[model samples]
Target: MVDLRGIRHPLRPAGHGRLPAPPAVDRVRADGRRRQGLILGWRRRATVAVATVALLAVVGCGSTVSPTPGSSVTAPATSATASGAGPAPTCGPIPPVAPPSGLDQAGWWRDRTFYEVFVRSFADGDGDGIGDLKGLIGKLDYFNDNNVASQTDLGITALWLMPTFPSPSYHGYDVTDYRAVNPDYGSLDDLRELVKEAHRRGIAVILDLPLNHTSDEHPWFVGSKTGTGPYADWYRWSDAPQGNGWQPDGSRFYYAAFGADLPDLNLRNPDVTAEVTADAEFWLGTAGVDGFRLDAAKYLVEDGPTTENTPETHAWWRTFRSAVDAQVPRTLLLGEVWDLPKVSASYVPADLDLTFDFALDTGYVGAAQSGDAATLMRLMTNVTKLYPATSGFGAFLSNHDMNRVATQLDSDPGQLGVAADLLLTGPGVPFVYYGEEIGLTGAKPDERIRTPMRWDASSPAAGFSSGAPWESMSDDPPSLNVADESASNSSLLSRYRNLIHLRQLHPALSSGTWAPVASDSSSVVAALRVAPTETALVLTNVSTEPVSPTLSLESSPLCGRPAVFGAYGQTVTIGPELTAAGGFHDYRPVATLQPQSTVVILLGP
Candidate 1:
């Protein structure tokens, strides 16, 4: 394997390439002011109130390997089509699922880690220059169950595929047919095989569901223009337009807040809601998709100029959740609410399984760049209270819509590692943007952000495809390819694997109650993960210099000697004063921490 472990690297800080600013729209962008708006706005709109993660917890202690699932014994059915000429290909009955209990549960999403892939650029198995479901199937082992020597699998438990439906745009957001897989990507059978293989490996597949809008080319949208079919009222229509949503037809105007091509669906219509419900049922029941990443979740109902986080929007999601629950109990519905926690909190438990936390991502990176533990802790403190006990947040460093994490942190591996630590060990479900684990760098126009996966340094398209890839490889694939990172012990890929493995092995890290580690100063940001049988502390030093902070447990006492776990394989133990009962103890005070390093200590039951 090609290895670059010994190479010395420059401390590149920001400006490697200009990171793209978030979109101008308030809902999509996750800026400080918007987060403040979400916080302040959440208080104004609040109907209710709200709310780590060790080791065998780090590595599998006595974990049993799940058997590889067998291929379909029955012959695959022919493509299902509602209309022979239409692009909407209906799905056939899915094979029965004997789903694993621990990781795939609805409430258990917070305990799992997810990786997002834009299928068009993820992998190209047929050498046709576009990534398809088959290509993604080919790369499933890289996420988990490869067992390749010297290679570190990312160990992500869930896969979030960006919109795979028939759409006019490259991003697949403006869907023309919700029931059909894009012909360019693959066929319905190909998706079935991918899901089967993913399930076999114990990974849940989450498809992107764009419920708010449809392509102008969609049959429903077309019928709406004529105002002469059942679909005439499927989309919001008006003789006169308003705000950003008024798209001009021959004589009438339709609502399309995103653009003229994406007309917002009329959620107020029962027929529209029924269609959506049936569409979701097809994917969950017939296609066997484990969950969904609901797109434009916050913009379902607009009030004049205000079209975000409305009461009707929240109620509709509750209804949507009920439909999903009927089909597949405990199926995940991860909402794409890029707004701040306060504003996003309105949809928790009742409306969604989770909401994306952009503030945690941006704030953590900002703190890591400056090595400011205090700021990171402050952000975490606020975030810890943003959700209900039954619901969780979706946390990530970068995504398909934004600049890649490596570029945002200026390619600093240390800062990136700290960011990963915060995501993996902190309180929320973590979603890794495809190729982010290997330091894949890209910026906006979205195509760059959704660049192809780098498998090998020498492959023509970095082993993503034999044909010309849709986007060019990032400037330095030699240093970032999976093969190179897998060979190196000290690679970002390795760190991600270790962290995920730790999360899986330790219940405390995955689903435990969270409390920040009390320290005198903010140089060291730490938290205690208290589970029923497991107790551990996750500590990170964000500063450039070593820190020896006075640390103590806020609630329970340290019962035993701390067992250290971290990226660099360091040994750490802190002394605590023993109480008479032998279980509780007070910290003797200070513990030394390494710069830009994370340490997990097992405090014991």
Candidate 2:
């Protein structure tokens, strides 16, 4: 056997490479770096390490390591005629996503930590029972706070507010008027202030744009009842009961995807598309906002009654994407197409930049809860291959619609730690749910799944509201709140911040191309990637047992590199000539990766 401990490093870490960082960047890139070499690693493709990595790739990376959207089985490339070859979609040349502010919407996110704010549950400004934009404005510092954004020095780069449009419902997903702002959440000016404040802090803001369905009480529904106004076609009406789009009207009727209470807009109608596009444009064009978090993107233009994802629906998205790109070139377009991989990635070339990696979230959480670290390890390897090279993906543990991740895993903090590691360090953009940093938990209760944001752990009302408060912070207050967890590096908040900052410091983990490392058992997870500036190893022990894995650099770009990036658990020996032995033992930080933990260790420069 190749003995790692038996070998010796004849050269020091500094002796590895003389290549300096990119000559372009004025600021530091990633991997504990403030200023980094612009270009590093893999300058020459024809090398022993690269060749070996390709050979080991077959064993290290499994083609069967499927995704929730589609099993690892590669779907056959669809024919143009199959998707309906009408016209080679001609898109007008739109401005780039880079707005004059130099916000770097696309590149800016290459290394960013996303914070999800449920407005109604965040900070309360007016002492009213509900949370508002002003409340969020007050907590900008919390977001801008170094502890959360990792760049308190520079302020947050982006803020994703839960659905903020005018609505009668508590969560606000049931939009009443697209043009108006909810009075309960403050006025349009309030939203403008929040956006302005965030921008001044060098941050860009993204509001949740729910376009799937509208409240039954929405004015458009009332207008459609008479088949009048510029919105008659906005509501899907039915002359014949053909599919799910039919309902009883005065003489005839229409169908609403949701119950009769929610009338689905006919996105097939160009006017409807124009209006929705205009609404989004209003936020970016007039409000100076950065981008949008599109809700229920898959549900739009669904096939008949069932919520199926179809290529026609994809056509609708293409139209919408063309409009947005034209209006705000550098703006972010994040869709909530919480479903499959291929279907989701299809929206990319159409111009939809990113979407929720529900596939990874589901698979990651399942692995964590069951203590199957193997799945956690498979996550990065699978998605890194499936997702488009140019697209940005949002990684989150839990959000408003689903059960809190903690609730699913029996509230096990250790497992939660593993989940955080997967999202923050693994790949793509990392998003932290509103009260996630603080251990808040509560599922759908006619009450908001989004519990109010708690500023002080000990303060009564959890600093969310002076009024009796809309919901309870987890009953396990002492254990979950920020006060108890912030200082504890082991606490969720600290772990998230550490990973966030580390992600910012290391270029490899940030915007890096991933490669999985081959191990003896598929049970213990291990992988590698060539990050923006460095090479590193990512390891996670899904199970409780001490997993001693035989790791080889044959699958990663790390073999020949001198320096790498990552954090380890227990202890490991790095043998000269690149051999590792006695894989980390029980609970020993094989690279400081705590059992049921996520650890990224940098190896070469």
lDDT for 16 in candidate 1 is 13
Index of the highest-TM-score prediction: 1
lDDT of each: 0.68, 0.58
Error of 1 at 426 (Å): 1.2
TM-score of each: 0.80, 0.77
lDDT of 2: 0.58
State the displacement of the C-alpha of residue 480, model 1, in Å, after optimal TM-score superposition.
1.8
Candidate 2 residue 208 C-alpha distance from true site, Å: 1.1
Q: Candidate 2: where are CA atoms >4 Å away?
A: 1-102, 146-156, 302-307, 376-380, 446-448, 457-460, 521-523, 553-572, 575-593
What is candidate 2's lDDT per residue for 298-406, written digit by digit as tens? Answer: 8788565565567667778778877887877777788887767666655664547787788878877777778765665566666766675422577788888887777
Which candidate comes out best when scored by lDDT? Answer: 1
Looking at candidate 2, the ten consecutive residues that score lowest on lDDT are 50-59
* TM-score of structure candidate 1: 0.80
